[model samples]
Target chain A: MKQKRMQGNADLQKLTDLAQQLRRDTIRMIHHAGSGHIGGALGLADYMAALYGWAMQYDDLDPTDPDRDRIVLSNGHTCAVWYAALARSGLIPLEELATHRRMGSRLQGHPARKAMPEYIETSSGPLGQGFPVANGIALSLRKRVSQGRVYVILGDGELQEGQVWEAFMTSAHYKLDTICAFINYNNIQIDGKVEDIMGIAPLADKIKAFGWHVVEIDGHDTASIVAALSEAASTKGKPTAIIGNTIMAKGVPSMEGDAKWHGNTPNDAETEAALEAVGTNNRFKDFPIANRA
Target chain B: MYSGNKAMRDAFGDALADIGAQDDRIVVLTADLTDAIKVGKFKERFPERFYQMGIKESDMIGTAAGMAIDGQIPFTSTFAVFTTSLANQAIRVNVAYNNANVKIATSHGGVCVGADGATHQAFEDVALMRLIPNMTILVPCDANEAYKATIAAAKMDGPVYLRFGRIPSPVVTGADDPFEIGKARILRDGKDVAIVAMGAMVPAALEAASILAADGIKAKIVDMHTIKPLDENTIIESAKECGCVVTAEEHTVLGGLGGAVAEVLAKNLPTPLRMVGVLDTFGESGEPQEILEKYHLTYSDIVKQVRLVLKQK
Candidate 1:
């Protein structure tokens, strides 16, 4: 019994390590691209790691597997981490991450299904729209009796959009328990702080009022994220909302909790420091940067 | 005058119910207009597949797109004004951009919405929907055509915008009349002039053609139902046969049937054309007939436009 517990801990540690590497990759991709959302991507790395590494039942070989789990990134601007996770998991080639945001690159600034339909479920850029779509996917999976869960990640600032509230009502009203939504509560928007721009504070009560199974946790903690996802999966009769408390730029000293890095890309020095901070050796050694303006 | 003819919305509802019976993947969604949009029959028949999306049109559209992505054919219905104008972005991005198999069935199209006023009436739905890529716009001529269009939209693989009216108009097209997307149906053929129309104006165009026939002016009547992927061939053929053309519809002359026909004629045929539709104005609280007449959308309007076009020719 003790051995089994230790093994589980070791697996979680591996996931954490994978998340650190993804964080470094995200920084490198954005730095090379010269433009990308850095903060949210870094903030969402651990959640993506937890989902792709442990929770999701996805086959990189058979991407269109009927029983594979569906992951929708509602905050599509933060697609760097998702791309990194997909690349690391062998769903997409790691070298392709270098061509991010370049013309004809599958790794677009936003998650576009047109670019890569096999892995990206839907083309998403406009905020607060993906959650409702995720609800529809969940409902569809239920109708098909596929037993596949739908997971959606939304940014805290995106909650200000009215459509998100409408989706929240829909998920609960239909009792779409198959949908597990994680809100990256980084408390920062493009312009400034999410609280100052338009506060969605008392978010827990608001979501509970919408009849969702609400769970708040430290988003960066692999163990907590894994546990919350497990709890969400077991939850029935209503959709689960995991409010993942996160920093805007996690694992990097200069940009952590900073709003300026929300959409700003890292320069050469900043990229090197971010990689060092993430503790990833041989940063992007295998991935060759695509020559594009 | 109200014939024993059913409203296009009623036919749409009936057709959806019939289609849903055959294809279990056919799901119905409404923005609190299940009864208003006449989708109640679908709701009654398939309670499990029917989703009441409340008063949120935007959410309904996005949800339908999601459902479409997951391989379910979602037919969402609501007021034309709300669906097109209010939820235009959702339809553009989610349904059209992604090429999701979402059938947007909008009732209460044009100024025929009567006492509901301009806020409810959708005179620019076709124009708005036409601008989106991968969007097929169907403005059915009569109840039968609407029914056929609804069934056809179900079979279609991409995004489709099916527009119907609130008031009960004449059932000019019979069950035998062929209804196909991107194909115009010639109701009457003549050499003097071509009266190209769609939706409620189709019956009006036929009436105008008969009036012109008596006056020694032969007018060809064409039901250009499918607005986008428009039958440019038919329009050009009709223009070549007849020296002049008059486009009519229960929508704005700016970008509806009139605009579509004009586009075809200008680029390819380059014939004399006059448009019979609302002249860039909103409708007020009045009866359906009163509003249509006020906006010059009557048979007499078609007749007048035909004469004016002939004079131009």
Candidate 2:
């Protein structure tokens, strides 16, 4: 039991290091782009890092392989984190992270499947769409009898769209067991706190009532995310929803839990502070830093 | 109710089932309109391939797009109003934006849905779909054409919107008639005025042509089945010969077949044109014929439009 606990600690440490690296890369990407959702991206660093690091069965060389586990970014504004995950995982060239949201850049403001057809499971920016697409992928996977799972990320506020509930009902009704929804239960959206804007609280109960095997975890904790993902994969007879309770801009202390960082990129001083806080991911050393000195 | 004359949705559903038999990749999704959209045949034949998406049209579109991206040819069937109005953004982003192989096979287009009322009818479906890039819009003439179009849509790829009517008009086209995605079919030969029609309006255009023939006007009748990627070659050729053009449809004159044909004529030939359709008004809950006549979408209305365009020429 001691040895197993140590092994788990080491695993958590590795995931923790990777999450910091991803947050660092995401901060630089947004700082370079001059505009991106920094808060959600930072908040999702842990989820994305754990997903691409050890949880998902992905091959960067065979990115287009249909059998690979799919990541459908339903709430696409946080693509900075997804791009970081991809780049840091060696799925994409780390050097290209600087080209985010630029003219003719593949790393679009929103996740465009056509831009990176091989890696992007589905293109989505509009709220409440990626869930159904994920369900579709799971449906197709079920038909093919392939050992592939679809991991879809959702924002708490995106649940307001009536289509999300429809999608929730669809995955449950169809018994698409291969789908796992990771809900970014950050209270902040564009306007303000999610509850103040429109409460999607009692979110776990809502998803559970929709027939999903629901689990709540600290969305910023890599170990909890991995554990939740494992629990979701093992749960049978229905789809699963991991309600990840998270703070906005989780990595950077000054920005954490702040809604202002949602679409606001960090300035020069803030970039230095953010980089200092979440150091650099050794894998992405070649990635350029854009600080307006 | 008549032999060889079934609703366009029924014909489309039958064709889809047949296509599903031949091609294993064909899957059908309905937003709780199994009987209404007449996709019951496909659902019955391939229960595994069919998905009952409850009453969620938006979710159905996204799901179809999801399946399509995975190399499955998914056909989303529902009433035109729900599919276009409620889920138009879903179609725009998931299918059109992603260029996914999703066939949006919609029924109950226009005011032809009998007593289903204005809320259930659609006059802006074609317009809504046409605005999206990489979208292929097909407005088939009759049941026969709808069947042919549905089969073609399955065989073809990318984002496709095939608008089908709710009423059972005559089976005007042959079963084995040639059908392609963006190609227009010429039904009658004439040089007086080209009557470009789509969906239920084709039969009216044919009758209108016959009426014009009695008065020494050799009107050309065309089944402008494929609205988007409008067959400019055929329209221009017919316009040059006919000197004037009468575009007819059961939809609004704003953007259906009329808008497509007029855009073509206005750009290339500058032919005298008159659009015969609902004049930007909501349809009422009445008999299909009463509503059609009220909206000036009947054969007589086509005749008047034809004469009106001829006078312009």
Candidate 3:
């Protein structure tokens, strides 16, 4: 028991360091692109870092390994952060991280399978559609392969789409224990507060009613996210839904929970502050030294 | 020609059960249409693999796509109209986008849905499915053909839409007959005109050919089942052998087998063609036999179209 706890703590620390690096990558990439969703990316940084760096079992050498567990970004707008995490995880080169939103860049406005194998399982942009696609992946894995997990992340605001519930019901009906669905409950969408824009209150009860094993956690805490995802995987005979409580603009003090920061590019000064907050200056070391820009 | 013995929907279910026994990864999902689409057999044999989505077509397709992603061959069953109209987004996103291994098993296709009328009859099903990219469209002629098509659909890697009619029209093809995707079979050979048909209309075209053969007109007949990746070689060859062509189906004239054949003919040989199908119309609630005659989807209608096209020659 003592040894297991020690190993868990060590994994969390490595994830935390990677999370900080991912944050730095996220800030610099969005700043360079001049157009990208920053708030959700920052908010999801810790949760994504935990999945790629610690939780999900994937191979850096082969993306389409038949036995590898699949992680799908249902809310694909936050590809900026996901790209950074993938780069840090060695799934892609760290230099390519800054090429986000650039013409001919593998990283695009949305997560596309063409960008990098294992980085993106499906191309997603339209809201409320990825949930079912992820479920399909899980169902396939459950039926064909012996042991594989499917993790999908959804924005809280996107839950209002009826298709999410439809997929949720089906997941539970089939008792898809191999799939884990995460909702980044940032409480803020592109327009305004999610409650104000569209009331998604009692979200936990709603998912529980659909027969999913529900877990509530702090989205910014790496350990909490990891534990929740691990627990979801361990639980048998039911699908898992983790309702992550997150601040939309989590890292930067000035931008926390600000709806305006959801999709806007930070200015030079703001970018500097954002980079400093994450405690990284690797942004300036560019061109051949770090050709990702 | 044998008729009124078995519905294609029943054959779909029986074949699915047999396929499930062979391939454990094959799962059968339906929108609360287990009995309606005859998937009860699959449910009885492989209870664990069968799922009923409870009248939600969108969710049914969405979940089936999910199953496909894991390398499972999923057959999502529902009425042709609902799957085509209500669940098109799921089909386009979940199945077509990633090219998931999903088969859309649709029953009650075209005006053969009889007493259920326009609401149930799926005249535009072929049109809707054909418009989507990377979708294999198969219209099985009878129970035997539906059985063969069901097995073929499971073996396909990408998205597929297998259409089956409600009425038991004809069991023209033997159960052991060979069936291959994207290939058209010549049922009868003639020189005056060529009749290209699918679904319940294939046998009608054969009957029309016999009548024309007696008149010494000799109309050629081809079963063009796979509509999307149409057998252009067979269609063009038939058009070359016979200067005129007539395309028949139990669907709307706009975009069914008729439209597919016409599209091929227009681009390839520019043959003079007449289409025998629902003429830009919706079917009404009546007996199955009455609906076929009323909508002009009969052996007589096919013969008339054959004569009309030959006149253009």
**Candidate with maximal DockQ:** 2
Q: What is the C-alpha lDDT profile of model 3 across A155-180, one tens digit per residue?
A: 99889888888888878987889888
The deviation in Å at residue A169 for candidate 3 is: 1.6
Q: What is the TM-score of chain A in candidate 1?
A: 0.94
RMSD per candidate (Å) reads 3.0, 3.1, 3.6
Best first by lDDT, ranked: 1, 2, 3
User: Candidate order by DockQ, highest to lowest?
Assistant: 2, 1, 3
CAPRI grade of model 3 = medium
**Model 3 C-alpha RMSD to native:** 3.6
Q: Point out the higher-scoring one by DockQ: 1 or 2.
A: 2
True contacts kept of each: 0.66, 0.73, 0.66
How many clashes in each candidate?
0, 0, 5
lDDT of candidate 2 over B1-313, digit per residue (tens) = 1245678888888888899999999999998889888889888889999988888889999999889888899999888999998998899889898999999989889897779788988988898888899999998888878888888888887889989888888778887788887788999999899999988889889999899999999989989898888888999999999999998888888877788888888888898999998788888899988988888889999999888888898
CAPRI classification of candidate 2: medium
Off by over 4 Å in 1: A1-10, A281-286, A290-293, B1-4
lDDT of 1 by residue, B79-185 (tens): 99999998998898789988999999999998877997888888888999988999999999889999999999999899999999888888988887788899999
TM-score of chain A of 2: 0.94
Question: What is the C-alpha local distance difference test score of each model?
Answer: 0.88, 0.87, 0.82
Please identify model 3 stretches exceeding 4 Å from their true place.
A1-7, A10-13, A30-35, A61-67, A98-108, A113-119, A140-147, A230-237, A253-256, A264-277, A281-293, B1-4
